[model samples]
Target chain A: MAQDSAEAANQRRTTARRELIETQIHEHAARLFAQRGFAGTSLGDIAESVGITRQALYYYVKSKDEILAKLVADLTSSVVTRTREIRADTTLGHAERLRRIAYLTVMDRARDRTRFQLLDRSASALPPELADAFLEGRRLALAELRGVIEDGITAGEFRPLDARVGALSVLGMCNWVAWWYEPGPDHPAEPIAEQMSDCAVAMLRSEPTGTDPLAALATARASLDQLERQLRIDNRRG
Target chain B: MAQDSAEAANQRRTTARRELIETQIHEHAARLFAQRGFAGTSLGDIAESVGITRQALYYYVKSKDEILAKLVADLTSSVVTRTREIRADTTLGHAERLRRIAYLTVMDRARDRTRFQLLDRSASALPPELADAFLEGRRLALAELRGVIEDGITAGEFRPLDARVGALSVLGMCNWVAWWYEPGPDHPAEPIAEQMSDCAVAMLRSEPTGTDPLAALATARASLDQLERQLRIDNRRG
Candidate 1:
């Protein structure tokens, strides 16, 4: 039993080491790809940047295309996973869920801004299968966002609007952060994410007058009651 | 006099024809670049696609880079022009101006979706001067957008928020149409533009409760007046 356990622990260490190296390779590759066009970048350039031999780089990735595919897959899968989690959370209101999803997306894009920028510049050049996978992932996330918006509208948490457009607008607002957001003291990711998420929720919020007729009436009644009390005090003074 | 007039009219016709052919070249080059990418495309390929000889293509554009530079210039200049006009229009309220600007941006992006997609994929590869010009134009438009949002907040038409973030969110919402919008009967540009513009306005609109304290107070006063009248009537009946 001791021998078997030792072997398993050794295998786990090896696997972790491999993953760490692969991640380093991906990071170096993405930075190089962002600075130099993917076509202009080569496996040797990435390997050199990662301080590995060209042959050693082959142990982690097959080709430059594989690195790009992996980057895109990582981005898309994370989006899908995060959005799916938000979509399935029953404890949160639709508006709150949407806000959380937008916040997470903006944060993710900001964190991986370089990779996102590389993808933006090279997505069209991706091979058919890779491109399809990336696009499918995006479509899944978009659908999940739209579903939340639809639920919000039905539950009267959001204004009645085309859910698809609303989802796209929110997605666009968050995704565009990849293009423009610079992580600096002046523009931290947290506050920018918060602002973007708030804007997304604001886009779908129902107006106060139309959100709930009963609520509006009650508010008016309460205001009138207070005003009447003040008027009586003024009458006594007169 | 007759000969001079004929020469002037002939010069006008030549200029018009040259302009028409140049537009065609740009359209074909943009489509090819979008499909094959900037690096994959060649001047010969663009010329052949435009049904012109390489030499003739040179007459229309000095090089492929020139064509790309013109495309970027056209897009950026149009954005700067339209937003600047909207910024200066004193007749429209800030919200209306913002809506109009968003609407026009969406419409413009939809119209040039192909070129915009090409630019998105290849902008990083642009030579420094061209890229600088494009970025400067974008910055100008963004500043105009931010200015409008600032004015709206000052005027109490919009919520007090980071105008820069608000402007970027709106800009992103509209620019994203270039990536996803398809011209079809089901998704006409006009309606989509309207939806996007309305969303932009919604993002910045002040809540009714806070938009105008005086207006809220007036509403309360009107409700109190109605309630007092009803009470008097009930007292008379008793």
Candidate 2:
């Protein structure tokens, strides 16, 4: 029994060390990939940056290919997993669930900005099968969001619009967080996430009856005309 | 007078030929940059792809640096210029102007997907000053969009929300077209732009005075509860 416990403890240490090494490699590689284009960055560069020998680096990752693939796979699976968790919560309403999903996507992308940027810009560098999987993963995420929008429409919680278009718009809005978000002492991720959630929900909500956009424009135009006329009259009086 | 006319005609021909060559070089270079990345692609590769000697290529463009700069500058100027035009039109209401700006952004991005992709992915490759300029141009464009949103709110044409957030959300929704849009015989830029414009407008329109998002959710919950109660009563009766 003591021998078995010792073996289990050894296994745990190995796993923990593996995790630490993988993370260090990824962070270093991502910085290199960002500074130099992915094509310009090499495994040797990553190893040198990580302060490890190439052979030691090989123990953590077989190639630069594996690191990117792992990064993209983790990004995809985490999105899928988190989205499912939000979906499985029966207590939340459809709109609230959507808000959470939108917020989560923006937050996740913001927190892992470098990883997502690599995923976006360097996706072409991935191997053929890996590229295909990455695309499929994105397609699945978009489809999931579309399904939620459709459900909300059916539930009378959302306006009836093209679900595909809505999903794309929402995803685009959230995905852009990776491009411009920066963490600062004064600015926190929570507020940005909440703001995005509100905007997304605003986009999907059903239009109130009797509020035609064109009609609203017409009203605004008429009001502008009246204001202009009144200003002309005042100018004449002066 | 005859000599001057001849000189003018010769200048026109030279300009036209230069334009043609520049277009060819840009198209080929953009493809290489997209496929192999900016750092991976070299000027010699571009010249070979363009079927021109490297020296001849220099006559059209000083370097690849100039090509990318021209592309980014053109993109920024076009967006800034177009947004200004939309803003200048007094006949169109605020929402209509906003819609056109949104539509134009998406359409422009969709039509020039390759150039836009290069601009986005190769941004880091630009000289530091160039990168700063590029970011500033983007900031100006977003601020212009935000100004329009603020005008709409002041005019009482849109619901009051954080204009900065609204602008970012709209721009994000439109910028994403570069990532996924593919032009085809059946899929035109117009419809996609229109759909996105509609979505953006939908996101900004004033909610009906009587409708509250949270209140709506509460009502939905109550209705669900009533349905469950009715089902229970029917089951007991049976």
Candidate 3:
């Protein structure tokens, strides 16, 4: 009876320990991946950073690529889930849903910028299976954008342009922020999110009635200036 | 006199051989770098691909970074030279200059995509000195766009948007094409260029005549559909 109890306790401990190791590995891998890139970093380096033997790492996870797959998998799944949910909301006009998605995407990235950064850069290093998974996730997201474009057209709220290119333009504008974005010290996420959403929405509107391009552009310029200044000023002083 | 003639001939042959080796190194490096990123690719692999010893490759170029830098330097110089010559014309509006630059960028990419591809991916690998050099070249080209935008705003030809952000928007819409653009089998360059120029002009028009939101939305949807079908059916088939 005592042996049976001990075995149960041991199994529970192993599962808990495995989970802890995974969480730590993920955290360290993200930091390292962003610092040196996926290809530049090795399994051994990750193991060292995690304070474990290489053999111990192998016991917990199969390879570095698996760790990357896990890191990005949540993001991909979230995007698709959000896109599908947004698309199914038939009551909202296409433009309205698209605007919501845009606003939400900016906010999402604002909350967790590191995930976006890793997903963008490490996409090339994904093996075939994970690559397909990632690509499917991307295609679903892009398709959602196109659906919004189509809905907007059917609803008569936007101009006619190639949906794919328009989608690309909107996404290109958004995804680039991962590389250059910084939250304004003076303002918070709300204002930045509004401006980014407005930029996407304004670009969609066939008419520029009362549009304010300078507002967002000024904000973007100031934010970029802060980033460049930080590199020179903060890096040395800190 | 005969000895002097032989010396000049031999000098020309040596120069020709050096140029040939340099070209070979760049070609191999670009292919390898694209397949396995800049950080992932090593000098040994590059030399092996070129069928030369590591010492011989070094004799031609000082280091791997040198190969990356030269690729961008040549392209950067070309872009600046082209932009400066156009800016000197002094007879075009912001729209026309934008058209010219967009077309030139596209045409240049089409003619020698390999060089520009290297520049696009490897610019971040540059050392501080090389980074400064390459950035100055980018800034020079961007400044030409800035000039056109500033002039447009001053002359009341464009709405009062921040010229810098607007400049990037227009350039971003154009340069991002390098990421996914393929000269489609059905649509050749000239017609597509003309249409793209029209799109850019339409984007910047200072005035907007209010149209029904619903109709505008429908038009946008149609365009997006066309674009989706237009994107290469297989982005990874290559």
Among these predictions, the greatest TM-score belongs to 1
Question: Model 2 over residues A91-192: C-alpha lDDT tens digits?
Answer: 998889999999899888878888788777766767787778788788888878888889899988788787887888899999998888887765566666
Segments in model 1 whose C-alpha atoms lie over 4 Å from true places: A1-21, A36-44, A52-69, A210-238, B1-19, B36-44, B52-66, B210-238
Q: For residues B198-226, write the lDDT of model 3, one tens digit per residue.
A: 44554554553225454344334434433
Question: Candidate 2 chain B: worst 10 consecutive residues by lDDT?
Answer: B207-216
**DockQ-derived CAPRI band for the predicted complex in model 1:** incorrect
The complex in candidate 2 yields a DockQ of 0.19
Q: Provide the lowest-lDDT 10-residue window in model 3 chain A.
A: A207-216
Candidates 2 and 3: which is better by DockQ? 2
lDDT of 1 by residue, A1-238 (tens): 9999999999999999999999999988889877776778899998899899999998889987778778988988877888888888999988899989999989988988888877765666677788788888889989999999999999998998889988999988998989888887556677678768878888898776623545455445544643454344333334
Query: What's the CA error at residue A136 for candidate 1, in Å?
Result: 1.2
- DockQ of each model against the real complex? 0.21, 0.19, 0.07
Q: For residue B147, what is the lDDT in candidate 1?
A: 94
Please give the CA lDDT of all the candidate structures: 0.83, 0.79, 0.68
For candidate 3, write residues A75-151 as lDDT tens digits. 78888788779878988877677778877876776655776766665576667787788878888888888878777
Cand. 2 TM to true fold: 0.74
Per-residue CA lDDT of candidate 1, range B132-189, in tens? 8888888998998999999998998986577888899998899998988888878788
